[model samples]
Target: MANAQLKEEIIAYSKRIGIDKIGFAAADPFVSFKNRLLEQQQLGFESGFEKGSIEERTNPSTLLPEAKTIISIALAYPSKLKNAPKSKKGDRRGIFCRASWGEDYHHILRRKLQALEEFILTKVEDAKCLSMVDTGELSDRAVAERAGIGWSGKNCAIITPEFGSYVYLGEMITTISIPPDTPIEDQCGTCNKCVEACPTGALVQGGQLDSNKCIAFLTQTKDMLGERYRKKIGNRLYGCDTCQVVCPENKGKDFHHHPEMEPDPDIVKPQLIPLLTISNKEFKRKFGRISGSWRGKKPIQRNAIIALAHYKEKEALPTLFHLLESDPRPVIRGTAAWAIGEFTEKSCEEKLIQAKNREKDPNVLYEIDKALKNKEFDKIQG
Candidate 1:
């Protein structure tokens, strides 16, 4: 069988299996990507959630020995939520980014990749194949860019002409050699909306990101969020979409091709207050299927507190106070203290003072003192 004929068959098969876009590329070491990773490391900009070493990340051969071709696939997701719930004054809602809207994309993409692998094995019985989604060592964007599936956007996302940047990427490396696709030319030309719109200046420059300052990364962390980023995070319980939302290429691009990728409005945009006391089992039952819940309930709970603060939802003060005094996790307790500070109610001060007296953790104590000082500052300003 000719490699070109196999490539065509793979593309046809991919479409039947729900893959929106498919491209092939030679499996060579991603040299430029490795250099960028080294620079990110030296600058302390990595998000710390990345798996594997830099060498393994940029070299496809390291993941699959004798890798000759890499096949990249893209599946577009819906940008706008249909019949979305409203966030009223007393009932504020937190959002998970569009990437986390439907089922966990990792599972969806892996399922498709596995089917492709099985199909490839049927064509060439001796063929070797390895597939990965977001968690894979190989960079999906790098592979996608090289494979001509999309141009790497200035926001550091693979932006396809059909789907814009609202696409989930996955790839598979195989021993079979296929004619590679031409790389897309960079189309971001002169636009800097994504960089300018970044709340914390996380998009340090076009095509480069400082993940430490990224709200998307910050929301996933288990520790107390930095004070400066709390308000910037707004109502996002998990992930951030400002960069993608503001991209010119992504304008008016929304797809509902796959039923599994359709978002449930209530799940992606749940009320902020109830999340404060949600049990682990309840959290799993509600959010376990989405990618945003990967970091667990603590980060989401903490972000929910910050969202309540961002809205200045006085109705949440009682819940915040309870968490401040009684939540076992320091991140939760500390974040609750910070949320309480946003309120000008007289009881907020009293609650902080009471928590300060009983709080044994230095981090929690520091947050309590900061809230107390902020309350004092508000009084002075008034």
Candidate 2:
């Protein structure tokens, strides 16, 4: 069986199995990508969630011995929520990014890759294959770009012609040789919308990111969010979509090919206040399946507190006070204290002072002190 014929069979089979797009590339060291990653590391721009060392990430052969061809797959997810719920005055809602709207994409893309791996195995019994999704050692965007699946967008996403930048990417490194597809020409010529619109200026420039300043990365951390980014976070409970939302290439590019990728409006954009007191079991039952929940309920809850602060939803003050006084997690308590301070209520001073007295955690104490002395409140009242 010729490799070209097998590649054709694989493509046909991929369509049957719901892979939106597929492309092939020669497995080679990503020299340019390695240099960029080294720069990212030197500048402390990595998100810490990255899984592998530069050598392991840039060289596909290191992952799989004798790797010859790489197969990259893209699955398009819905960008627009159908019949989305509204975030009203007292019942404001926090949102998960489009990437986390539905079921976890890692599972969805991995399943597709597994099916492709099985199909490849059947064709060539001696063929060796290794598959991975977003968390893999190799960069999904780099592989997808090399495979002609998409051009690497300035937003650091693989922008496919068919689905724009709203596609989930995965890849398989194979021992068998296959004719590779032509790499897509860079189509994001002179358009700087994504970089310009990054809320935290996380996009340092086109095609470069400072992960420390990225809202998407900050929202997933377990500790207290920087005071500067709290208001910038807005109502995002998990992840950030500012760059993607602002991309010209992604204009009106919503796709809903897979039913599993469709978002539940309520789950993806739930009311913010209830999230403050949600139990771990309830959080798991409601959001456990989604990728945004990977860091667990702490970050989401912390972000929800910040969201309430952003809205200045005075109705949330009671809940915020309760969390400040009683929440076991320091991140939650500290964030809640900050949210309470946003109200600038004279009544909150005693509560903040009391919390300050009891708070053992230095971070929580600082937040309480900031809340107590809320200079904006004093300046306005004076």
Candidate 3:
């Protein structure tokens, strides 16, 4: 099959197989993309990519030695969450951003790409192909832009007309050449809503997102966080959607509803007390597929403590006290102490003093002292 005929058939196959948009580009060296990837590494903003991304992206031959074309595809997962709230209620946990609410896109999109690859191989007889969703060294946003699916928004997410920025992207690297699609123009001119809406200021300027300050990243980190960032995390137990929710482009748009994306009854609006008390066995059983469960129960448990402190949920006092004495992580203990201070009253002051006496960790001691002081201040006020 000639290259021109192959390219046309590939696009047709993509649309027929549930892909919303498809674009083709020669697998040239990603010079510009490499520079940005390196810059992210230098700035320490990259999560898991910095360690080896430079070598893989700088040499196109690394991802696929004989790669001649890159086909980028987009699939929209519209937010059709029934009974989705207008505003967060007390001690509530919101669902993952629309993109991740369903069965993992990696599984769904990979199957589609594999079928596409098989179709192409049957036609060309000797075509070689490789498919990547979010797990590859190739720059997905950069490829999608070049393939003309959508342009990067100020929030650093690809924005599509059909689904706004709530879409998943996947790519196929092939040895066959295809007609390149014209790249899309940047339409986010002077729009600052995404930046303005971010609760943590993750969006700096001109599509640069500092993942360090990103709520989504902070909530999911396996390491312990200080009381400072914990307070800002609010009630979000997993990934955040502040920027996407506030984008003007997403206004008046309806999300594609999927049954799998529906919020679990307990997770949708979790009670802090119940969350703080969940056993590890229960944690994995309930949240294994949810975004926050990937780090196990520690982060989510810690976030529950933080939310209890933020909301001053007095009902959670016994649970927080148990954690203060028995929780394994010092960070969790400290947040538990903070919650004790914020939620407990004169009735709990003696326990706080007792906790301070037995606590070994300095951070936990500091939190106990803070809680004691606040308890004293509350008595004076009353």
- Whole-model lDDT, model 1: 0.93
Worst 10 residues of 3 by lDDT: 86-95
Predictions in order: lDDT: 0.93, 0.91, 0.75
Candidate 2 per-residue lDDT, tens place, 1-382, comes to: 9888999999999999999999999998999999999999999999998988899999999999999999999999999998999998989999999999788999999899998999899999999999999898999999999999999999989998889999999999999999999999999999999998999999999999999999999999999899899889999988898899988888899998998888889999999989989988999999998899999999999999998889989899888889988888888898888888888777677688888888999988888888877887787569
Q: What TM-score does structure 2 among the candidates reach?
A: 0.98
lDDT of 2 at 372: 71
TM-scores of all candidate predictions against the true structure = 0.98, 0.98, 0.89
Q: Please write out the lDDT profile of model 3 over residues 12-98, one tens digit for every residue.
A: 888888777788877888788778777877887776623345767555568787998888988777555666554343444534555
Which regions of candidate 1 are displaced past 4 Å? 375-382
Backbone Cα, N, C clashes tallied per candidate: 0, 0, 1
Instruction: Give the least accurate 10-residue stretch of model 2, judged by summed lDDT.
Output: 372-381
